[model samples]
Target: MHRLLFMGTPDFSVPILRMLHEEGYTIVGVVTQPDRPVGRKRVLTPPPVKAEALRLGLPVIQPEKLRGSSELEEIKALAPDLIVTAAFGQILPKALLEVPKLGCINVHASLLPAYRGGAPIHQAVMDGCTETGVTIMYMAEKLDAGDIISQANETILPTDDTGMMFEKLSRTGENLLKETLPSILEGTNERIPQDEELVTFAKNISREQERIDWTRPGMDIHNQVRGLSPWPTAYTTFGDENVKIWKTEAMQTDSEGKPGEIIELTKEHILVKSGDDTAVAITELQPSGKKRMTASVFLNGTGSQWEKGDLFL
Candidate 1:
């Protein structure tokens, strides 16, 4: 078995770490980001990877900066043959990369040269791409520009949201890691450079990106709705109150109402006019300072104000 140091943080990286442990890879230690404050209590919490490492009785390191000479010295003393990283937030410096005998390998969630940076899975669905995949690459100084070691693709379903796509791609990446490690250890795997011209970047998502642009085409609005679901959800203003849109679906209509105007309202759905089409059936929502619930639930608390003819910013 090869000696390895695994680095990861979020839930997206957990599956691969579990896979590596089960495969008996001799993981010497795990490196993850320091705990973050979360929830109403403001309690500091260990990241998913740190928790997993603890559960498995494995050594873990939570360094605020890997570039610190002391941290680098500690890791180098382990004499790991390889460093495996998946969604570990910090950029790895060249000084640390040289510590591992076989270098580092990264499990990125998109087909390289395509969504090549942060939030790849979310950007893929938001862009309406027909397919997206995971890539296992040899890590380099640049961000996700390394030579590709292996890749696997999956089709994107029409109803797929960021949460669902993330689940799928995370597993796809885990399976790819399991299959590729053996070959890489034997020196048979090849790494190929990414096509520079085809490169596209996915910057970290912003709150502005979650604001529903009603002036845009219906499909574009719909994509944003799904892409941001369950976190920093798509939202708009209604009657000077923030209204979070948790779900939406397309509809055909000839109504010429202005964009952001509520064209119709029924017991089951709310039809909102957009640039080129209508968005019927926003099924769930959250009024400011309230928990998320079905549209019907929201209507009960603030009745009739959400009805037809009201404009949502």
Candidate 2:
């Protein structure tokens, strides 16, 4: 078995590490980001990959910064035959990249030359892309700019959110990596360079990006809500409180009110006008300091405070 070093930091990376272990790959060491302070209580939490590695009895390293760290030296001492990274969250230095005998490779969420930054899956869904896929490629100095080793496609359903797409792409990447690694080690797999002209980036999502723009077309608002669901979710202000919109649908009715105006309200939906003269039906949401709930449930409790003609600012 080839000695391997695995570097990753999230739930998406866990499947690949588990699959590799199940298939009898010799994962000599695992490197993940340092534990982060998470949530309302500010609890220090380990990365998903680190937790999984411990469960598997694999050796682990948590480096605050990869460059010029003794952790890099420890990784080099492992003398890995291959290094595999998936959503590792940091760029590898040249010294570390060159240490592995068969070279470093990455399992990226998008087809190369497109969506090549930190948040590809979310960006694709936000852009209303019809299809997206996984790309296994060599690790270059630049961000996700490596030559491709293998690629696999998946359809983007109209209802797919960032969380759903993450699950789908993580599994696809796991299977693709398993099938491709042997050929890669034997030097039989092809590496195709990406076209610079076609390159596009999926920049990290910002607080501004997560705010719902009610003035946009209804479908665009729908896509924004879907793409960000379940994490750093799409939000809007309702009076003095922020409400996270977890699910919405674009309606084809002609708007009888201005953008952001509440055109219709029921126990099950809140229909609001958009800049394009249509509306979006919000079906699920989380009010500030509240748990997520169906629109009907929320309406049953707070409906008395909302009336048609009210606006979500």
Candidate 3:
């Protein structure tokens, strides 16, 4: 069995690591991002990958940065035959990349030559892509500009959020990598260079991206809400309060009003006009300093006094 250095972080990487271990690969070590504070209480926490690696008895390293660190030297000492990384959160250093005999490959969350960079899954959903997939490719000095080894597609459902797509693509990536490794190890894998002319980048999500713009079409706002849901949700202002929206639906009615004006209020929805002359129903949200709640619940409680014609800033 070849000695593999497995590098990844977060829940999306856990399944692939487990598959490698269960399949009898000799993983020299598991490298992930360092533990950090999480949640309102600020409890220190290990990434999901590190937690799983420890449970599987794999050696784990959490370097804050890989470039010019002793950790890179330590990694070279492992003498790995191949390095496999998925969301490892750092580009590989040149010295470390040279350590692997079979070269390093990455399990990227998007199809090659498109959506390359951090936050591929989020960007795809936010951009309303109807399809996305995983790409197993050789890591290059440039970011995600790698030669493809294999690829697999997963449909992006209308209701699928970034969180859901992460789970779907993670499992898809794990299975795809498992199927590709034998070819890779035997040196029979296909190496297909990406089309530079078709390249597109999915850079990390910005705070600006998390703000809702009522001036957009209803479906666009719906896309924005779901793309950021279940983490760093889309936020807006309502009656002097900051509100994070977790769920919304683009209505099919002919509603018309100023963008952000409340067009209707039902027991289950808070329908507001959109810039496109349609309406969007906000179904779930979290007011500042409050837990997420269904619109129905908010309607009978903190939002009971809200009425139609009221505008959301």
Query: Candidate 2: which stretches are off by over 4 Å?
Result: none
Q: Would you estimate the TM-scores of all the predictions?
A: 0.96, 0.98, 0.98
Candidate 3 TM-score, true structure as reference = 0.98
**All models: lDDT?**
0.87, 0.93, 0.93
- Candidate 2, residues 1-313, lDDT tens digits: the string is 7899999999999999999899899999999999999989999999999999999999999999989999999999999999999999999999999999899999999998899999999999999999999999999899899899999998999989999999999999999999998898898999999999999999989999999888899999999999998787999998998999999988898658888888998877999999886699999999998989988998889655888999988
Q: Rank the candidates by TM-score, best first.
A: 3, 2, 1
lDDT (Cα, tens digit) per residue for candidate 3, span 198-276: 9999998899999888999888999999999887789999878889999998887787688999999999999988889
Candidate 3, which segments miss by more than 4 Å at Cα?
A: none
Clashing pairs in 1: none
Residue 228 shift from truth in candidate 2, angstroms: 0.4
Candidate 1, residues 183-270, lDDT tens digits: the string is: 8888799888999999998888898998888888888888888888767589989877888999888787898888899888877668
Candidate 1 residue spans exceeding 4 A from truth: none
- Model 3 has an lDDT value of 0.93
